[model samples]
Target: MIEFKNVSKTFTAKEGTVHAVKDVNLTIPDGKIYGIVGYSGAGKSTIIRMLNGLEFPTTGSVTINGSEISSLKGKELREQRLKIGMVFQHFNLLWSRTVLENIEFPLEIAKVAKEERRQKAQKLVALVGLEGRENAYPSELSGGQKQRVGIARALANDPEILLSDEATSALDPQTTDEVLDLLIDINKKLNLTVVVITHEMHVIRKICDHVAVLDAGKIVEQGPVLDVFKNPQQAITKRFVNQETSSASLDDTTVVVSELLEKYPNGLIVRLTFHGDQAKLPIVSEMLRQFPDVDLSIIEGNIHQTQEGALGSLYIQLLSEHHDSLQGALEYFNTMRVETEVIKREQ
Candidate 1:
């Protein structure tokens, strides 16, 4: 329901002009949690701000629900913003206000009746599992609870979409999972489209069905989360995926593979990646029976769960006394549709 077409944003600083977002085009489907991941200065935050009309592009257009958001201003933009809710890394709650008051603040700004606002706020508190904390101030709540209040306040106007900007970055791992589960529930129950911008891969892996990998103010890769994670085509994408999987670095794997090559010139060391039901295959055992001397040594691996299925990778040393047998095993791997790369031995 959101589209960015040839959108570019430039900032004029004393040093020079900076292109925060450059010719970035993307489409976010409705009723899905979409993630934009990048490092500090990758312009991910700028992309999300454009959705709420909080930031406008220097050139091109941003269309939300079929209307150009950049063309709106004043009352027009304010009215449109009500349909889009946002939560921040920090709770951003008014410390002096009680939980009920904070949740009611947005309603008050919208000029809802006092009694109606109170009732709406009460229901929201219950929705976020903070019913008894209605009277407690923000200072009394834990990080996760404070975020729940932020969520309740954001939903005061019954927004159709939610923008989460590093929503769980400041919390502990336990608290992060709690907040993520809450977001997933809210998305399903409310049928709300979500756009989450964060550097953490765990956030994307947990909830996002679609993802875009950003680097230097440009999108290097974008696709279904599982597909992107299974076979990353870009270096930046591989770096992030590897971080989440915590797979041993390619350099380290290369070192071990190189040592094996020195000992056995005829052997081949290949990296293999398996996904979905393929992970359960008895392919390795079957291969050993077919070629008695072919040895498969798994150096490092991990199984990552995505909405689609399980994805696993392994580095193996395939040993055979003859070159013909080694080539035959490589061909067998190709037939299984398993991704494999030969580790070239240095001359």
Candidate 2:
């Protein structure tokens, strides 16, 4: 397990003392994909730097499996860092080196024999689906190919923890998904712990099992990816969650709801949220059958899958001559464990 206990970091800049990180206590269980997401200057870089021992925490400790990394000196620190490999954002490859050489670079630094590193790099080249491109230089490979090489190289040392710092920020959407899928495969195959540091919430939604939302160096909200998506507490976190949501989603359906309300002014508009298996249930159909006096119109809906399960959001307009029928239908949905919110009630 990796842990940061009451960690904080400060810097003496040209202007004044700046606190890069403040009172962060985070735990990352072994063999799990974890994500730390925040905008620029939110201390994400500082946190990762401290984790790899490149920078020490000002007031606390960073420990990986009971070993204090911050206290280590010289050789010990170097060895510790080797156990944690970093994948950079810009594909920081050697201009002259080919893919295989880039994959072999770390092992070369560790002084592994030339033959041994060659064999290892070859195997990694195949592992990352770069077998045919092993001899291609960084300049020749595409963005995704270069990232694959970067990943292969990070795994050259068989790191226990992989730190991906904005590794996909520069890639297109399709390539971003491809890289994320590769990381997931690597995590499962190697049983390795992966820590992704990104500003993109979509990156967090795509790969991370657990996430922490950072703002101004503090953790505002965090939990399993599915939980946070279903219910985001902080304003920043809600904004992040809303980014991945469809424009017609329940989180930001103001315009859609307005149009629906204007067109069907004599009804109640509600937002329904379904968790896991609930998303698959025919609750709305059942509502129609059981509450015959009510009329329901499905507006917009979407289902998002996370590492945990499926989270579904739907918007519907319920119309009835009687208010009790609408309330009864809502109560029925409540008993079925579907979350409901009345978006706009007829005035």
- lDDT for each of the candidates? 0.89, 0.90
Model 1: per-residue Cα lDDT over 1-347, one tens digit each? 99999999999999999999999999999999999999989999999999999899999899988999989999999999988999999989998899999999989988999999999999999999997889999999999999999999999999989999999999999999999999989999999999999999888888898999999999999999988987899999988987786467667766877888898787788877788888889877777787787877877777777667877777788887777778888788778877777878777
Q: What TM-score do all the candidates reach, one by one?
A: 0.92, 0.94
Model 2 residue 37 lDDT?
A: 94
Candidate 1 worst ten-residue window by lDDT: 245-254
The residue pairs found clashing in candidate 1 are none
Worst 10 residues of 2 by lDDT: 245-254
Choose the strongest candidate by lDDT.
2
Number of clashes in model 2? 0
Q: Write the per-residue lDDT of candidate 2 for residues 94-143, one digit (tens) a residue.
A: 97999999999999989999999999999999999987888899999999
Steric clash count of candidate 1: 0
Question: What stretches of model 1 exceed 4 Å from their correct place?
Answer: 247-265, 345-347
